[model samples]
Target: MIATFGGGCFWCTEVIFQHTKGVKEVLPGYMGGQRENPTYEQVCSGATGHVEVIQIDFDESQVSFQDLLEVFFKTHDPTTLNRQGADVGTQYRSVVFYHDDKQKQEAEAFIQALEEAKVYDSPIVTAVEPAVTFWEAEDYHHDYFNQNPQNQFCQVVIAPKLQKFLKLYQQ
Candidate 1:
């Protein structure tokens, strides 16, 4: 099964899903954009209407979609619009590109449950959109955190975030 989520940087999201047990492969890509074959630079400019997302191919029998949703919600800020930490832009917006009606219903229900439970201080702004073209990111962007561990952004932003996710999800 495939699941697509955009919650802040693709690098950050990629790290979270890559560590997940049932996730077979996670591809960092851009979606919900107008342009075809959008480049990282173009998406960063926030002009292509694309959001940095991960196209996750997971084993549903091993990990349910709801479990993946739990990770998705807990890993990033869904309340803030088009922003996460120091990264701010439309390309960084929170979204779920559902592939089918079932995913759409589940996502909506999950958000409703969160709202009812008062998960965040503010209203959730995560967009639930139909899955669209997934333009894979440039070759260099793949496995970025592992490849660029010494990079300042990875050290300052991603490392700590990944640590928190590990602590929360690791058994």
Candidate 2:
């Protein structure tokens, strides 16, 4: 199964999904943008209309799409618009690019359930859209958290988010 999500910074999002049991691979990339083969600097300008996304190839037999959505919602603040911590831009918008009808329906249902359960203090703003062209980010952007664990942004931002996810969804 394949899942693509743009919650905020791909570095943080990729790190969280990497620890999930059934995830086979997590590739950090750019999606939902107008530019083709956009560079990191170009996307950072926020004019490309691309959101930093992570494409996760997982084993559905072990981890369902619904399960992946659950982790996605929990790991990021869906209520925030175009921002996550210091990462602020349309590139940081909350979005899910579904690859199939079933994934689309499941994503919609999950958002509906979250709204009904009042999981967020504010309405969920996660955009459910069809999967678009995904341009893989440069090599340095991939596994950024793992590579730069001591970096201030990773320490203060990504680390806390990862910790929250692990504590909330310990298996």
Give each model's whole-structure lDDT: 0.95, 0.93
Q: Which regions of candidate 2 deviate over 4 angstroms? A: none
Model 2 weakest lDDT span, ten residues long: 79-88
- Measured against the true structure, the TM-scores of the candidates, in listed sequence, are 0.98, 0.97
Clashes of 2: 0
Any idea what lDDT model 1 has?
0.95
For 55-115, candidate 1 gives per-residue lDDT tens digits of 9999998999999999999999999999998899999999999999999999999999999
* Tens-digit per-residue lDDT, 1-171, candidate 2: 789999999989999999998999999999998989999999999999999999999999989999999999988889999988778999999999999999999999999999999988999889999999989999998899999999999999889889988898788
- Candidate with best lDDT: 1
Native-structure RMSD, model 2: 0.9
lDDT of 2: 0.93
Give candidate 2's error at residue 8 in angstroms. 0.4
TM-score winner among the candidates?
A: 1
